[model samples]
Target: MLATPIYIICSPCPQVGKTLIARLVCEFLLLKNGTAASFDVSLKEPSLLDYLPHITETADVIDTYGKMQLMDPLIFHDRVAKVIDLGFHAFDEFFKMCEEIGFMKETVRRYVTPIILFVAGSDRSSWRSYEMLQRQIPPGALVIIHNEFALRGGLPEAMVGEHVIRIPALPAFLKFYVDRLSFSFTGYLRDEKDWSTELHQWIRRNYTMIRDLELRVMGRQSYKPTAPCGRPRWHER
Candidate 1:
C-alpha cells in the first residue's frame, strides 16, 4: 500500500506561486479522496489560509511554541492527508528543524510520505538553493517546480530534481478573477455556473497535472519512495 502523503510546498524565493500550488494540490486531493489538512507558514501574508479557510491553519515557526503548533499537529494528526504552504522567510528554519528532529524519517516510519515541491526562479541563487536542498533531502522527497510567471527563462539544468513539475502561466486576462477574495477553483467547481466557461477549462487542466503528479507522490511509475535510506529515482512525465 502507498504511504499517506504530506505535501510541503516551498521555495527559496517569495511570490513564486507556492500558495497557488499548495491550494491546487489540497483541492485535488480532496476531490480524489475525502479530507486533507494544510498549513500556512506565511509570516508576511498567510493568503493560502485565507483562501482555504475551511481546511488550513496558520503556523509560525520562528519560535519554539510556534514550531510545536505546526510540528505537533502534522505528526499526531494522522487522520488525513497534510499539506504545508511553507513561506520563503521560514524556509531555512522549517527544514532545519525537520532535519534535526528527523521529521521525514519519523513520518515515513508512521506510514506517511513527505513530498517537497520546491518552486524555482530564474536567478543563480535559485539553482544553488535547489542543489543545496537536494543534498539535504532524500531523493524522492523533493520535486522542482518551474513557475513561468517569475521564471520565463525556465529552470536551470542544475535545479532539476528527481521529479519536475510545471505551473503554466496564468492568462493575464483571468488574473483579476482568480485574485479575488472569493475566488477558489474548488468552490467554483461546486457551483453550476462555471461548467461552460474558460475558467472551468483552465481548472480541469490543472486537475489533470495535479493527478499525474500525485500518482508519482503516491509511489507510482518512475517515482517510488521506499523504506528509510532508500529513495527511488523520481522523474517527470
Candidate 2:
C-alpha cells in the first residue's frame, strides 16, 4: 500500500492565507482522490468540524498537542492525504509538543514532507516575515509561495530560489470579497468563477514544483534547503 502524504501548511506570521490555501488544496485533493482529508490545529476560532462537515462527524477531533496521544499509528497507513493547518500563535508550542512526543523527529525521518508557504504583500513587514521564516525552516523542507497583492512594491526574484512559486497578485476587489465572505458558502459561490480561473492558472504553473517536491521526498532523494541570505537592510516602503 502507498503511504499517506501529510502536508503541513504554515507561515511565520498570521493572516498569510495558510488556512485558505490549505482548504483549497484539500478540496482539490478530495476531488481527485477519494481518501484525502484535512484538519486544523488551530486552538482558537471555529474548529475544523465547523468548516468541514463531511468528516467532522466520524473524524477524531484531537487537540493540537493531543494528536500524538490520540492519533493511531494506523491512521497513517491508508492512501489518505492529510493537511494540517497550524495557526501562527500555536505553531511554536505545537512544534515543541511534537518534539516532546518524538513526533517531530519521526516526521522528519519518515516520509512526512514539510513545505513552508510564505505569503507577503506589499507590506515591508510581510517581506521581513518571509525572510525570517526562510531562514528558520529546516533545509530542503521549505518552498516559498509569494502571494502578490498587486501592490506597488513587488518582491525581487533573486530573493527566492528556483523552487519558489509566485502566485499572481490577487486583485484588490477579489481580496475584498474574500475577506468579507471567506468562511461562508456564499463566498465560495460568489468567488468561484474568478477564483477557479486564477487558481487553475496558479496550480498549473506550480503543480510541477509541488509534485517534484513530493516525489523527491517520497523517493527519499537527497535534498538540502538553502541557507537564507542576510536580512535586508531596508524594509520596502
Best-matching candidate per lDDT: 1
Question: Residue-wise lDDT of candidate 1 within 111-199, one digit each (tens)?
Answer: 66777888887777678777877777777678888878667875788865457777777777776677776787878878847577877
lDDT of each: 0.76, 0.52
Candidate 1, residue 45: CA error in Å?
A: 3.3
- Candidate 2 clashing pairs? 139-225, 140-225
Instruction: Report the lDDT tens digits of candidate 2 across residue range 1-237.
Output: 244566666654665566555655565556457556666666545444456657432222336425532234313435677766666665555544444545433444443444555544444555565565555556555566665553235555435453555656566765555444235433354456765575445444444555666676556534344344232211110
Please provide TM-scores, in order, for all candidate models, with all chains considered together: 0.84, 0.61
Native-to-model Cα distance after best TM-score fit, residue 76 in candidate 1, in Å: 3.1
For candidate 2, the TM-score is: 0.61
